[model samples]
Target: MRVIEAPSPNHEPRAAGVPLDTVVVHYTGMPTAAQAIDRLRDPAAKVSAHYLIETGGRVLRLVPEGRRAWHAGVACWQGLSDINSRSIGIELVNRGHAWGYHPFPESQLESLRVLLADILARYGIPPARVLGHSDVAPERKTDPGELFPWRTLAAHGLAVWPDPVQPPAETPPVAWFQARLAAVGYCTPQSGRLDDATAAVLAAFQRRFRPKAVTAAPDTGTAARLMGLTASA
Candidate 1:
């Protein structure tokens, strides 16, 4: 992917026998890409992704894929909590939710598609394991946010995306939603009731999948989409 080496000291060896089976996507969420790079290189900050894709289509390698870059803080996926040990993190340059979220440029997305293909092939990471930072840390994070063009990534075969859902005759029960999300690899609370934790997880799911109505208030489209996820995946 024609990466320019820009190593950061904020990384370490992955845990022994940790499978590199996942890829976590993130947006810088900072005011500028340069600022984001600066923070990532800052030792005290203790945060770094394996690579950063800039707005101008430049790719910077901050850490070797073999190491655990201090990303995915306090996160979990499926039943595994040591996410940083098992995944590769890619940071895209964008002023996410905090500063001013916007659509990624064509050049940036094109570069991302190429980079993702290389990483997926190198590690043999499955499409289902490709996730956003929000997916693994539902209650604590929402990055590579709703406007992040997940469907486009899916089109490139980087991940899965459900088709337009046919709203069901009746809304599926909350437990149904919980089961579907769990099956799709999210560490969702399978409580029969839609509690706060469940809702936040659903919101993270919606933010990536059914973004049109991300209220976390379960509806027919959301339910139908959930039902279709596994089949599509």
Candidate 2:
């Protein structure tokens, strides 16, 4: 619950009339926490997050919540492109996919749970809005990757986790999957084809909802999870 002030300058005033309603989780995809912190604080880098949690449960406030930190670059969510303007970005310290993908430590997750609870309550943001960086920018990024314990967060009502439902008896068409993904807040391809864009989005979706196998194909389990989320939404 202790937050150390370590402000970064790579932020700007949010656009007028934009409601802060989302929280994007990310991993500091660097070799070490010091390197990540240095880059985030470096004005030349021009990227930062509101908070950065180290592996040992230390939380650093990098950018004030009132300003738009330049974390979510070239991303879209639920049809909105100005994600940073309406979201608080939290970066978890980890040597992400580029270095060595691994499970987040228990202490780190514990801090995340505590931090998320406070942020969600204060901003009135829903659990559904607690999204991963990959969820928002599927094609370009995948931090806070598959190994992150989303189910643990869902248990605390901080994030959404779909119930285990049987995969559909038969596979549905690409268009069917497309509509449900859109409904579930993904900016998916609507071209009705299983193109690379659609697959990237599906892979990102699976990375969150069905992490065991991120096949990127419109498989039965992925489709079922998509259906379940869309129905609940």
lDDT of 1 by residue, 1-233 (tens): 58999999999989998899999999999998889999999999999999999988899999998899988999988889999999999999999999999988889989999999998998888888899999999998999889888898998899888866677899889898888888888888877999988898899999999777789778888887787787666
Could you tell me every candidate's TM-score relative to the true structure? 0.97, 0.98
lDDT of each: 0.90, 0.92
Worst 10-residue lDDT window, candidate 1: 224-233
Per residue, candidate 2 scores C-alpha lDDT tens digits across 1-233 of 89999989899999899999999999999999999999999999999999999999999999999999999999998899999999999999999989887789899889999999999999999999999999999999887889988888999999998876778988999999888888888899899999887898999999998888988889888877876777756
Residue runs of model 1 more than 4 Å from their true location after superposition: 163-165
Error of 1 at 191 (Å): 1.8
